[model samples]
Target: MKMRSLIATALVAALPGVACAQEVTLSFAHWLPPTHPLQPTGFEPWIESIKEASGGRIAIDIYPAQQLGAAADHYDMARDGIADIAWINPGYQPGRFPLHAIGELPLMMSDAKSGSRAFDAWYRTYAPEEMSDVYYCMTHSHDPGTFHSKEPVRTPADIAGKNVRPAHATMARWVSLMGGASVQVPAPEAREAIAKGAADMITFPWGSIFIFGIDKEVKHHLDTPLYVSSQAIVMNKDMVEGLPDDLRKVIDDHCTPEWTEKVVSGWVDAEAAGRQRMIDEGHTLYKPTAEDLAAWRESAAPLTEEWMASVNKRGIDAQAAYDAYVASLREAGALMGEN
Candidate 1:
């Protein structure tokens, strides 16, 4: 996957008036119910940006919640040209997107804003070529995921023998490190799985529980972020390459740093709202101290070695990429410090 650098300045300026055979229509598919936090929080704003940028030259129709197929299918949908655009989770298709897996490593990100920044930095420095197949709009990770359980989970011993829904493979690894069995349950299934006794714990973004109505069955939440889950937005390769300059500019404009920050801000807002809603309903939030977190991280170190190996087998330089990602974050932090 190889992508040309940003288009020339002159061509970019004249893109809007570039004539087309007829009006173009783009269908973007996602796996959230209409009111899901991510959809309203970020997706809608992105679409509006696209529409406004297109200046009526192109039209977009948003299909939410597998109105077409699951999140796993989104990558393929865009690859096989099923839809013009799709919100995809590389974690959903394990063994295939090992580079993106770095974003899922246990406790890697402190917040969505940091994780999202890390994601962009990871792509720009390590995996941009790998993602060139699609016209990537942006990539972002969850702020942080806490433990939602029927019983309090404060330490490794507490998670022993529990069946937990690990949203991403990295979280699945966290479950293993904590001595818990892993259960495959998407957000929508969290409620049912908890209710049926199929799962005893879950790692998820707080705001999503309300969006998916899972808090009703979840009684307690851990304070520590076990990890963050991440996904990328991509347009069909051909569709993007063929876009007239104006429309391409619109795409670029909608996915900038400013927009990414807004997206993260929205998620944080939703998480705050969800936390309040759960507290209103008597859900208890507990924090495990640094000592407890150290214990958990010790058990989780083996996972990073195994994961790096998994990515290496694919000819991807996992450790180097991870190192570069950390370096980029430090660089970003320093720049922020200067500001």
Candidate 2:
């Protein structure tokens, strides 16, 4: 019978190579809080090392707290694919990522694995025109950032008229250049905007104000590493161009810079063990005084001269990318506080 129609046309040409060898989850979205430690110690052990280097054919379905949307819409939900991977922050959209605010300047690099390997090697030298669309997969920072107040701010005249909350937009223009009043929420609504007082001080990081419970509604903690929050993890560029080149080289061998210093030094050692469990749950932590941290670093020196005139009006080379990100954090000794 024509050899049974040539073995049913070779099983219909091997059914699209057995449906392209099946298995491929992805999804990922983020906005923290899956009992955050950037989710059980940084994206569940980097999604189990990209499902054991893709032999399991890649799988990952995260979608933490924001469950796939708001936290400033996770970099446009991974540039509109609505999440094939996200976790972005890029200072939660301020001026749409102004050169990732040089790892949110101020007192840069103290931890978060050498400021996430010097802001993922200086934002991969401007990620194809500052992160072209998507697929950028690394860049991290967050271990510094202070004043989780309810009072006791130390200096900069105790952050003048309060109502703070900053976290992005250069700490909301360094809390409107040290005179507070910048309230823009979103760190999971900053513990209900500082427990319904509608914010009186937030600017977190370093145990993320008790991983977003805002340390049971603030009581003051300025341990002073003030400023660091320039995250990224993007993916969806047509889902990494519809992967498969060996699961896109196991997502480019776990999108590295040595896995951005092993997933930001395990979320900066879980923000130094959540700031020593908010100083053993007592929480009035303070610690400033080097002349009140030099008057809060001279009131944050005009936020690094207005972030080098907004990265030299976008032409960039903002002081050679801030002196090669402080000489790659003093060649990775991880030069903490007092720049």
Candidate 3:
């Protein structure tokens, strides 16, 4: 029996394909807290799918809350191989990815689920050029974000001279356009900025106000799906290219629009629930009137123009790209018509 076992082991080891079937382990790094909804609701299930799909040959270790790198540095971390995969807020490093800024445009989409599907599908075309440093896996957005402030912001003019912490670069630009000053800070540091009065307001998704403890400092909420900030899950380019075919197939299968929608659904539901939580807590929710909405949209119009000019300067067909993005949103029924 012992001789038979030895012969079997020897036979397995001698086969070239069997010898190369060693398990692959990867590091996934993100800046959200371990308890954040994205951790359990989005990333874990996706990770599990990959593990099962690969027959336990691939293992991913998650390093959350900036354990591996800073929030803004995540893209670079993945590119440099500091992390095998990273969750990146592309707008964190403004102007670096001009083509991707289309997703951050104000009032472009109404919800995260369908919007995520549209954004992920549309981005695949541009990712190879805009985010070429890394292997683009999937892209998603939070539920649309609105203003939360110590003081009420009823109109675009209300932002004038105020200090606001924006969700992304496009929001920062919008704040500036409205004559407000932007207190640029990453998500983990947002609560501190608001508490210290460095920022008197924040543009954030409804659910994260409580998740990041920003609700304690802000009492007024704007009832609008003003904008959605885009996020990407990317992998190291060289590592992806060097992977064995079977292992690479596992990764590829998980990086599709289907997987993106599945992962973002939980977060979308959680964030949508925050509106009721705020209401129950007696926080003031300000709904915009038709005129107010029109004014806000007018103020945001230049943002698209700015994006177009900026990307055109980068030698891209900006108009064509914008049209495609809008087409994707319309197809998904996520686009909010001009109001």
Q: Give one clash count per candidate, in the order shown.
A: 2, 1, 0
lDDT order of candidates, best first? 3, 2, 1
The Cα RMSD of model 1 versus the native structure comes to: 6.0
Clashing pairs in 3: none
lDDT digits (tens) for residues 1-339 of candidate 3 = 123434655677798777645466788999999999988999999999999999987788899999998999999999999999999999999999998889899988996898899999999998898888899999999999999999988999999999999999999999999999999999999999999989999999999999999989999988999999999999999988877798899999999998999999999899999999999999999999999999999999999999999999989899999999999998999997632
TM-score of each model, in listed order: 0.87, 0.34, 0.94
Q: Candidate 3 lDDT (Cα, whole model)?
A: 0.91
User: In candidate 1, what are the lDDT values of residues 41-91, reduced to their tens digit?
Assistant: 787777776777777656678898787777778988987788888988888
Candidate 2, residues 159-220: lDDT per residue as tens digits? 88888878888878877877778888778887898799988878777677776677887877
Candidate that would win on TM-score: 3
Candidate 3, which segments miss by more than 4 Å at Cα? 1-19
CA error at residue 125 for candidate 2, angstroms: 17
**lDDT value, residue 210 of candidate 2:** 70
Give the higher-TM-score candidate: 1 or 2: 1
Model 1: lDDT to the true structure = 0.74
19 in model 3: Cα distance from truth in Å?
4.5
